[model samples]
Target: MSHDIDFAQSAIRTIKSERDAIDKLIPRIDGTFTQACQIMLNCKGRVVVVGMGKSGHIGNKIAATLASTGTPAFFVHPGEASHGDMGMITADDVVLALSNSGNTAELVMLIPLLKRLGTPLISMTGNENSALAQAADVNLDTYVEKEACPLDLAPTSSTTVSLVLGDALAIALLEAKGFTPEDFAFSHPGGSLGRKLLLKVTDIMHTGQQLPIVSLSTPLKEALIVISQKGLGMTAIADSQSQLLGVFTDGDLRRVLDQELNLHTTPISQVMTTQCKTVNADMLAAEALNIMEDHKITNLVVVNQQNKIEGVIHLHDIIKAGVV
Candidate 1:
């Protein structure tokens, strides 16, 4: 009981401290934040993020968020920049330097070279009057009242503020550029997000010989044979022009059996559902999943603008493609 009480007290204190820091930070989001966002939005090239120690870790994440959200960006170590990495900076690019004290020696040494290249600089610093802030084209104040560390040395609140400010700048630029989910997915094509946004119905749907389809005039037994042979649990009923007319599934077969209909003599069109849900060939797989989930169905017919069946999509296809 004593140990639990101690853990709870410690957790509470940390939360309160971070909360206080964040509350203090709210008032600092003013014209300076807007100016920083503008610089990045107007940049013709990438945003180069540079920092040291804990700030460097935050800078790396900031760069990643910016790149994925439509702003081209990369993280460059300040120490490496002084040796030879400085060549990465170009006149067309914008440099976002992060430093809590605003006096990191390595970062400061690159200022002259950065200016010589005519690259615009935005400084995220706790000290507004430090060398970095003074030399920056735009200074974003990320000052924190104190670190959450009991000793006030381990960078907690300061790093949080810097990271949150970086996120603010990235999101602001994203809005200004009118970036969409499709654009974001392009940048993250290897992840699940990319699969969700970039995967199309055509990419995963069963087409050509794999599509289970039968003419509307096909006998119910023949349609059941096609459905069994294709193993889709459903078959599309099309007209002479190959236009989709309806769908006959296992559910329909069961209902027809209950009615004592003669499967051998009945036409598939007589038992097929005329009002089935269909998707376009070019629609996103995510949208297709939504339709299946909303309609509480497992299978869908992929059609063209003329309502001709092009292919078929199932819940299994979406699962295989990692859209779910």
Candidate 2:
């Protein structure tokens, strides 16, 4: 209810604090960080992340990032691990533990169990010498000078540093594994990325009766009719053997009208675009989109190795397929 309260100033201070905390982590990406990555890279099983409270929230995100970026990982709550979820972890797995204080009771309790299983332990902690960090095979120091919280009680700056460090580890592993965008798309099959990477021109092209095709000897008026009937705004000019010669589009029709040419008598080949763009059946739809964008064309002719017309791809098709 204090109208004059400086909420903006408080927010700016908090942002600066977290930014500083992240900056401090740059020098700490040392040999220990490399050792942790090597351990996880050699892991035959998943990287099991464990944390409690605020750290637990950051751990969940870290696990998801790892899984999406070519690293096999999942999160297990520390409290649940003590009860029975410890069964989920194996000797072949590596454990990633997070604790700002490095002395979280729930996480510390699982240290003995993890050690007994002979699992490699990697810890992210604000205190390098705390119980959890001391027990870790490779410890990452996530220490910050102070919390963004004015009272220095809330988990603010510490959580941001941990999240950034986790992201760094995930990216490093991703690069080491040579993970490609196609591989990332496979993990996210239901998203737009999958459609862009996996969907091909053949999957959405109009073939068979839907193809707008006109012969080289066909009259311009008749070709226009075929284009109108096919609703593709263009008609491919091909020979008897279905080998593409050229294309006539709505733009060509406009140019013909300007010249007062006899549409009924003029042949389609006389006005067709000889250097029309064409894409292969196996080409990615996203690549097709780039071609369309670069050439400022709406429709593309799909052809085979012999330059035979196979189908027609429209901008609307790629948009409908969600590759755009």
TM-score of every prediction relative to native: 0.89, 0.88
Worst 10 residues of 2 by lDDT: 1-10
Candidate 1 — which pairs collide?
A: none
Clashes of 1: 0
Candidate 1: tens digits of C-alpha lDDT, residues 31-108? 888888888888999999999999999999999999989999999999999888988889999999999999999989
Q: What would the per-residue lDDT of candidate 2 be over residues 1-324, giving only the tens digit for each residue? A: 657768999999999999999988999899999999999999999999999999999999999999999999999999999889999999999999999999999989998998899999999999988999999999999999899999999999999999999999999999999999999998898899999999999999999999998888899989989988999999999989999999998998899999999988999888999999999999999999999999999999999999999999999999999998
Q: Extract clashing residue pairs from model 2.
A: none
Clashes of each: 0, 0
Candidate number achieving the greatest lDDT relative to the actual structure? 2
